[model samples]
Target: MDLNSGAGSLDQFEGGDATVRGAAVVSTRLSQPTDEWFLEPLSEIRIGATEFSEPDQKLFSVTQFVTAAGRKFSVPYAVATRPARGRRLWRAKVPAAAASS
Candidate 1:
């Protein structure tokens, strides 16, 4: 995939159907099959990122995804060409009141 920072340039990450040879825990969920997906980092791996300047121009922060069977995939950048609903989905915080309930 190819990612544009919306700063006039693009960043790219490439991966394919191969076994991810490592012992790291990660999780991902797709709101829609083709629109977007969210990656959660349960280990010391780089799951996602966010650009502080153009905060509203991001979609998802995840740079890659590795399935439970070890298949790996990647995107072009940290952000997508759409509006993100939350700030850094990978690192998002839950309200204390909501958590306690």
Candidate 2:
């Protein structure tokens, strides 16, 4: 299913059977408005413990711009932080292609 296509889009396949072993799932309609689109980060991200060593610091950032129902929403630098890093280390900016297909 296309994640970008919102809700009712999957209604068409509601009564379909799982007979086909390798058939692709198809949706009837898109959940979101056609005009509405997502502007996601097409680049790499990098976050290390050094960047969040301080008690209060920006750990990560995100930018998103989408238009829905004739209204526009812009999110710039959605910053987040935590008191301290846990044993589970995290890394950002890793090439997505390298990690997954």
Candidate 3:
């Protein structure tokens, strides 16, 4: 699920499976379009949309960066966009943890 920069260009990340074993979970925030926040060595992400954030007050739209072994890591923007803003991303972690939650 690619992130929307909100400026009609896609900050694309390939969709990844959450249930895969040993998947790496990463926490990320949406930055302004000018801030090309690239994940080094991680050959993933696409582009679309843009928005500007205030310098003093940084807004973090947190989301799950899920990736299983031998696959590309991705930012789950669909879940990340629930509130359309702010830090609202959550991962159930493991099945047992999900059940407990």
Which parts of model 3 are misplaced by more than 4 Å?
A: 5-57, 70-101
| lDDT score at residue 69, model 3, on the 0-100 scale | 36
Order by TM-score, highest first:
1, 3, 2
How many pairs collide in each candidate, listed in order? 0, 5, 15
Considering only N, C-alpha and C atoms within 3 Å, which residue pairs clash in candidate 2? 6-31, 45-92, 45-93, 46-92, 46-93
Candidate 1, 1-101: lDDT as tens digits = 12233211211111434433333332323355643554433212233443333555445544443444445544434444543332211222345998899
RMSD of each candidate relative to the true structure = 15.6, 14.4, 11.8
lDDT of 3 by residue, 1-101 (tens): 23433312222212434322222222344554535453422222222212233562333333323332335323332322223432212322445866699
Query: How accurate locally is residue 4 in candidate 1, as Cα lDDT from 0 to 100?
Result: 31
Q: In candidate 1, which residue pairs clash?
A: none
Q: In candidate 2, residue 57 scores what lDDT?
A: 43
Kindly give the stretch of ten consecutive residues in candidate 2 with the minimal lDDT sum: 42-51
Q: Estimate TM-scores for all models.
A: 0.20, 0.16, 0.19
Q: Candidate 3 — worst ten consecutive residues by lDDT sum?
A: 42-51
Pick the TM-score winner.
Answer: 1
lDDT per model vs. reference: 0.36, 0.30, 0.31
For candidate 1, give the lDDT of residue 23: 33
Choose the strongest candidate by lDDT. 1
